[model samples]
Target chain A: MDQEVINSYIPLFKDAFLLTVKIGWLGIALAFLLGIVCAFILYFKIPVAKTVVRCYVELFRNTPLLVQLFFIYYGLPAVGISISAEVCGVVGLGLLGGSYMTESIRSGLEAIPVIQTESALSLGMTNGQLFKNVILPQAFTISVPGIVANVIFLLKETSVFSAISLMDLMFTAKDLIGLYYNTMESLFLLVIFYVIMLLPVSLAGTFIEKKVRFKMFGD
Target chain B: MEPVLKIEHLNKKFDDFTVLEDINLSIAKGEVVVIVGSSGCGKSTLLRCINGLEDINDGRVLLDGETVNPGSRNLTKSREKIGMVFQSYDLFPHKTILENAILAPMKVQKRSRKEAVEEAMQLLDRVGLASRKDSYPRQLSGGQKQRVAIVRALMMNPEVLLFDEVTAALDPEMVREVLDVILDLAKQKRTMLIVTHEMSFAKAIADRILFLDGGRIIEDSDPKEFFTSPKTERAERFLRTFEYEK
Candidate 1:
């Protein structure tokens, strides 16, 4: 509320912002890797793996990330899998984000017709080369919007990682609120910081989508 | 002379629906086989099975005296001898015409980029698309894309090329340009199996015509005999519709 108090919180907010970015980005990277793997598993319909990934996607996508984080941080220890809080938060967020990513990539793949593969196979491309060289690139370009949307959504989802005391922005804001009993100031700052950070990403998503859609569909 | 490609007792189905039933056919070295039939008669499915794009329920496809099995790891290697063009141009939208033409050569055959591009350029030139080589698939006209697709197939030096209604998606004026390219390739003695509804084009270029009805080869004979004197009632009726178009 006071000018001096607000000024003093700036340095602390900067560190918390960086921490949010660190965990957010790590979660995003893991999600991206898992997204491609899960998509391929379902795309090829690889035996038992497809069913397992299907279950994983259905489970993660349908359930709230809060419950997922809670299960990993608190519930998994009951099953004798004691993961650290940081790992729990990141992995839970990654898996949740990845579930959404799988759908995105799958939709991208399906947009390409069966004729494309037929054309590739006729040219003597092995399944591996077909997936890597032909299918993946086209899927990726078509997937740009979904990928970008998932990342931006995942960035906001990282805010919930604060529940596990991950020291992210929300957790840092809560700490400051507890210290000074200035909930309005800290909460307002939290919302402002998130909006400020996410605005560029949102804009970039639209710009990239337009450029790629134009290249692919000419509209 | 040995047949370059052979299809013996090929059968294909989609779930319970039988699309192709006990089909037997073959193409000799340098022969141009044109497949013409009403839609849903399995002409496209037959070519798809020959190139290993569709898994046949029961059949043997022999390419150059070797039995070709779609399930085998070497199937991809075997497909080097088979080229296929679809009704829709399936050129990689992201790459240039030159890149699309050279991709199979560089990736499958392990040819150097320089060597593949050099050969691709010559083929593109022959197809009259060398001037548009740097353009992407989306940039080209339907006929230009089809021409580039042909050049891409030629770059693989395929022993046989399959065209599945390649001009079906093109405009009437665009059809001749693409057909001229195929005609030139045929003159050079490229073994081709073309599935077309363009009765005139098929009659012009086909050495042999296979008229299919209800998933069976209703008539297989020279273009003059098949067109002028259809052997089956189904073939005769199918030809009647083409008369108005001509």
Candidate 2:
């Protein structure tokens, strides 16, 4: 509620918010793409790719993303492979998100009944027609809620990038507070920034869930 | 006459568990054959094998005198010729009733949307489900869904249709309504292989009844003959049990 203190840090906050948006958006998009590819690779049981994705999902899901961040940002530089903090943040989040995303997508695809698939097959549908008409529509219904939840989680998780000096909203808030000693006011702005970015995403999740259900069941 | 559909010495097994043992059958162009059996008698497996859904350990399924391979890359040509309706009324929950009916023709037959819709509508109208064509599956009753499933199969203009316990999942009252639609199809002389427990419907529609037991057909004869005087002791015992249960 301290306008005098908050107003001074607004310019820095804006840059951090923009950076958060850029990295979070790119990170989530990358995760989604990777998740889809991994899920399909498992679904089709592609020889080498399936095994690779399985091991990747297992490795990432079992560990903490924070440790992964340190390993990528701190540990990679030891081997002469230096990367920007922003790239490290995105890579860490993307791998973590993609691992969970694979499970969500895989389960969503698995929830499609064999009967529905067999019905489409018996109708003489080619692989393309079957996917477009049956599999994709059903998979979307199963995957949407999980995906939206992941997106919001990723938005909040962008704060973790501050450890790598990525200058996200959390880092900006920390800097302003350390200099001005306004802990509550600075943290309040960070919370508002996240809610602004994420509320619509949660709403979109419910909207898509209802629409897909209605299309499938008419209720 | 060359059989429209034939199963020659079809032996199907899953691991060490045998489902069908040296099964052989043939259906003429307009024959209505009913397969009746106790539970676990491989009747449904036989139907699935004919549709190439179940890969037989031995023997081949011939549709129009050509062997249908389950593992073939492009089996659509054979699949489009042999239609199947399941006990669960496996209509696409996402599509409307008409869309379910038209999917095969539009995709496999490569017919234009208008042509497919036109033919699909006629089939739906014939089954008394024309008004429900635009409706989703959940909006309909079990009987209505089963009828829609029948129309969906018929839309392909398949050479033969397989009904694998279509009424097994319906309530008692709903069963008759679904069976009545099949009765109409029977009157039209559509070639069909039916596996059912509804004895009266079988008696009414079947030109021949094949009684299966222990993964073997114990008796294959005219419906009147099979019911009146079952040839095997096992067939007679099966009828006796069903009669006692009723």
- How far residue B115's Cα lies from its native spot in candidate 1, in Å, is 1.1
Off by over 4 Å in 1: A77-84, A181-184, A203-215, B13-18
Candidate No. with top TM-score: 2
lDDT tens digits by residue: candidate 1, A119-214? 888899888888788888888889998999999999998888788888888888999998888877788788878987799889989988888777
How does model 1 do on interface RMSD, in angstroms? 1.3
Pairs with backbone N, CA or C atoms under 3 Å apart (clashes), candidate 2? none
The best candidate by DockQ is 2
Estimate TM-scores for all models.
0.91, 0.96
- Candidate 2: TM-score, chain B only: 0.96
- Encode model 1's per-residue lDDT on B1-246: one tens digit a residue: 889998898888999999988888888888999999999999988888887877889989999978777787778878888888889988988778898998999999999999998999888888888898887799899999999988888888989999999999989999999999989988999899999999999999999999887788878899999989888888898999866652
Query: Global lDDT of each model?
Result: 0.87, 0.88
Q: After superposition, which runs of candidate 2 have C-alpha atoms over 4 Å from their true positions?
A: A217-219, B244-246
**DockQ comparisons of all candidates to the true complex:** 0.69, 0.72
Question: Per-residue lDDT for B1-246 in model 2, tens only?
Answer: 999998889898989998899888889998999999999999998998887787889998899988886886547778888889998878888788988888778877888999989988887888788998889988899999999998888888889999999999999999998899898888899999999999999999999999998788878899999999888988888888767542
